[model samples]
Target: MKKLHHIYIISAFLLSSCSPKISSLITKDYQSLKYDEKVVVLGLNEQQPANAEVLGVVKVRDTGFSTKCNYEIALDKAKLEARKVGGNTIKITRHKKPDLWSTCHRLDATILKI
Candidate 1:
């Protein structure tokens, strides 16, 4: 019984630590830009799956656990910018709950201009 208790505690800690945190793009202000223009994002830590396709604009809401905020944009336009950038990583800013509640995930990406 004592060993089982220890296992449970360890598992709980691991699960809590692995939980995903809210993240947003930290670049040019997303609010001021036009919807049709592509924004550039930098310093993204994770690589988006190669197979993942931008499926139009999505407004994601935070569920407080294993979930995060969302945004909306033109799918084809976003993909075009992503391909032009030549890098899979996009910029994002992380947010926490209670102290950090917001209506939208502020994120945008832009292709480097040659």
Candidate 2:
């Protein structure tokens, strides 16, 4: 029993240290953008383009066992989600850096078409 418990703990740790998680809520449907299409990323305080239209929201977070959710990676994932939802821009709504309880960056952004 002790050996099995140790094995489970090690397996969980190994898995958690492997991958981050990304999620999105798409409110409007549009033709998906091409892979090479550009998706502009805006900071939290940055103003969106005047012609912007809301598409949905996206979030990049660390699963309890996730280890690779750094700021750059999270931001990129958000942008990718935006493009998939046919958004031409993404405005960051929130950002949380790694802290005592978490070793990953978390991001939230609003997807838009401009």
Candidate 3:
């Protein structure tokens, strides 16, 4: 048990389990973007209203930090970039576990507009 506990603790520092890291944003291949519009952030369980069109997909890879707090920061960054592309809403598609030690949190969202 001691060895297991030590390993977990060590992982936190090495992987930044709960730390907030910089968000690596990906936004592209979007056509018909509406700029200067209000955007709504939605989680997986949340439902989006009617007549909304999907703008584009945005992926955020937040490293060093791997926690909800960090994801929120990354989400904020994603939203900011989405707005620039005229995204009025974002529907989070999926979240994945760390693919590697340095790359901690991975968030996938779909940008939408009405």
For TM-score, the strongest prediction is 2
The C-alpha stretches of model 2 lying farther than 4 A from their native spots are 1-17
- In the range 1-114, model 2's lDDT, one tens digit per residue, is 999999999998898667778888889968889878988889989998888999999988888888678888888788888878789899999999999988999988999998
Ordered list by TM-score, greatest first: 2, 3, 1
How much does each candidate deviate from the true structure in C-alpha RMSD? 13.7, 3.9, 10.1
* lDDT of candidate 3 at residue 61, scale 0 to 100: 68
TM-score per prediction, in order, is: 0.21, 0.81, 0.55
**Residue 20 of model 3: what lDDT?**
44
Candidate 1: TM-score? 0.21
Please list the residue runs of candidate 3 whose C-alpha ends up more than 4 Å from where it truly belongs after superposition: 1-38, 63-69, 97-103
What digit string (tens of lDDT, one per residue) describes model 3 on residues 28-50?
53543454456688888988767
Cα RMSD, model 2:
3.9
Q: State the lDDT at 61 in candidate 2.
A: 82
